[model samples]
Target: MVHYADPSMKYKLSRLNLARTDYLFSRDAAEYATYILNTSPIKANEGRKAHLQLLTKCAAALRDILVFGQACTVHRNIKN
Candidate 1:
C-alpha cells in the first residue's frame, strides 16, 4: 500500500485515478524526445536517447521535493 505524508495530494491523485506519477513522466519523456528530434542538432536515435536520459534525470530530480519525494520514500526514517 502507498502511504502519503501529504493527504491532499493523495486525495487529488485518487480523484484523478492515478496510482502513480509514471504516466505523467512517461508523457514528458515522449514529448522531450519529440522536441529533441525536431529542434536539436543531435538528430535521429542519438538525440532521442539523449533526451530520454535527460528527462529521466528531470524526473529523478523531483524525488527531492517534499511533495513528490514522499511518494518514493521506502523507509520510515527517510526525509526529503
Candidate 2:
C-alpha cells in the first residue's frame, strides 16, 4: 500500500510539474510567433515560407508541451 501510494504521489507531482512546463513553453512559443510575425521582413515568397516555417515550429513546440502536460495529468490520476 505504501509503495502504491508513493508511486501515485510521485506521479501526481510529476504531472503538475509537466503541466507547468507546458504552460511556460506555450507562452514562450506564442511570444516567439508574435516576434517572428512582427519583425520578419519576408516580403518574397521564400521569405514568406520561412516565416511560416517559424510559426509552424512554434506551434509544434506548443503542441508537444500540451501533450506532455496531458500525459502527466493522466499518469497522475492512476492509483498506485
> Which candidate's lDDT is highest?
2
Q: What's the alpha carbon RMSD for model 2?
A: 15.4
Tens digits of lDDT, candidate 1, 25-67: 8889899989876887753455345464566753335555465
Which regions in candidate 1 have their CA more than 4 angstroms from the true location? 1-19, 43-80
Task: TM-score for candidate 1, please give it.
Answer: 0.28
Worst 10 residues of 1 by lDDT: 43-52
Work out how many backbone clashes candidate 2 has: 0
- Model 1, residue 15: C-alpha shift (Å): 18
